[model samples]
Target: MFDWRWDFVAEIMPRLLWATGNTLMAAGIGYVIALVLGLFLALGQRGSNRVLTTILREGIEFIRSTPLILQIFFVFYVGPQFGLVLSPWVAGMIAIGLHYSCYLSEVYRGGIESVPRGQWEAATALNMTRWQTYKQVIIPQSLPFALAGMGNYLVGIFKDTPMLSVIGVYELVHTANAIGSENYRFLEPYTLVGFIFLAISLPTAALVRLFEGRVRSKMGMN
Candidate 1:
């Protein structure tokens, strides 16, 4: 339906490449934060304190219910009003990271729940503290179970990085849009963005599967 232009692609390649770096940074950094925070969130829901458990469970549900874009806006815009101002990059990272962490929390909870009740009973019989039981027994087993879900979300977060553009974080989609607006060639910019995402996503997803196998094998889960 529209014309394609190699010259325009050539003109925008460098900018797209630079913006790809920003996209990776957002995905990588945000994923790391989500990994750590999600663990705590999952653990908090399992705590013996009923009040704390209820609060955490409800909070995670609320986060999972809302759209991530609103969170990004809240963190970037409303945050300043509450003395929590941050740069676009930082705000987008935190917002998306926190959004995904709630999802990962559910994944972790499922993995944790999959562990045998006998394991918990044995830990109780041995008089291990809950923290010690989780650290020494539950976590090691659960991690392998959780790996596949984690891998899925790893790809998901990378794909979702485009949402950061709404907050003006110069990720791939934002850069492509800028380029299109400048050159009046949406085809080249958008097509390039799709290819770039596909290129990165396919390899990353494969690697995640490979790593999952390695982890499961290493943990004697396979």
Candidate 2:
């Protein structure tokens, strides 16, 4: 039918963009949490006590082995049963951050270990404390190795933001669904949603590739 209202597209566009903004904010916050928490997980898994490291390793394994969707559900629904009520958006962000933190910890650990043993020796020879060694010597050198993985996960988080719609987060996909339900026209809304997702993800992937090239070049690995 040629009865589709063109003006409706104009009206929905603003709301869709607004929802997209929310999704972006959620992703940004979630990634920050993942970055900080991932560092802690990496540190915890590596430093000092054998029992602590074992627990941290097992926790990482458990999180990595489970489905993120189930984890989201558990954080959102199960927590409420215990008198800790987190909003869907909050729970979704927390779940995503926690899930990705485990993965990022491995990336960090690999990056750190990949650094030359001589570098560690040099830091020790300089009488640098552990904190100073990591702060000044290790982290700076290991960043390029970790950067590619971090960028990959940032794009990954953007892609996964759509899944937050299931928890009433009102992301792009959620906006599209609402539009479709109201208009009984699935084609336009769904197509637009797909296009928006592609617009975001494709550029992010391209940027990641660019970053990877730079990192490789800097390391002379290219």
Candidate 3:
């Protein structure tokens, strides 16, 4: 006999909603960290020094090649051995941020590279400083190309936030698991989690696409 209880769903809805806030926080924080750090990584790869570029490139590759869960475990468990004890939230954000940063770095690199060589030449001819070239010319041009990838990873980081539950971050999935265990009913909680994710994700993806179109049109890349 399969049983679905509306009363149980109603009772747990508030708790799940609260946990949804935590999930969104985790995803938002992780994405911000990834966005900033990934930009730095991409810039590092583009720097003049071969040694720094090699090191950054290899480090990005290594992180990208490894499993994200292991990175989370390492930061959570092994960090203490190195005198770097971090709480679950800190560790989860750091691990997720760094993991996604590697991927985002590649996205940034592609975007940066997509900028025509003539633009760099024009910046040089105009006696623009390196920072000025990037700020005024390159980054603006690159944004449209990068927006799609950035949007994809925004959703990706949101989905991956559930992995933080392994270290006890109390995100939506973790809260759902806890609720299911306590109530001895897995069906409703898990179903609600999926629907919640779907609701958020579909709108987010559409908005990203819309934003990307606007950026492209504004930049005359369309």
Best by lDDT: 3
Once fitted onto the true fold, the runs of candidate 2 whose alpha carbons sit more than 4 angstroms away are 1-7, 215-222
Candidate 2 residue lDDT tens string, 1-107? 45656677787878888987988888898899999999999988879999999999999999999988888888899987999999988999999999989989988
Residue pair clashes in candidate 2: none
Q: What tens-digit string does per-residue lDDT give for candidate 1 at 123-150?
A: 9999999899999999988988899999
Q: TM-score winner among the candidates?
A: 3
Full-model lDDT for every candidate = 0.93, 0.87, 0.95
| TM-score of decoy 2 | 0.92
After superposition, candidate 3 runs with Cα above 4 Å error: none
Worst 10 residues of 2 by lDDT: 1-10
User: TM-score for all predictions?
Assistant: 0.94, 0.92, 0.98
- Please give the TM-score that candidate 3 achieves against the real structure: 0.98
Which wins on lDDT, candidate 2 or candidate 3?
3
lDDT of candidate 3 over 88-182, digit per residue (tens): 99999999999999999999999999999999999999999999999999998898999999999999999999999999999999999999999
| Preferred candidate (lDDT higher): 1 or 2 | 1
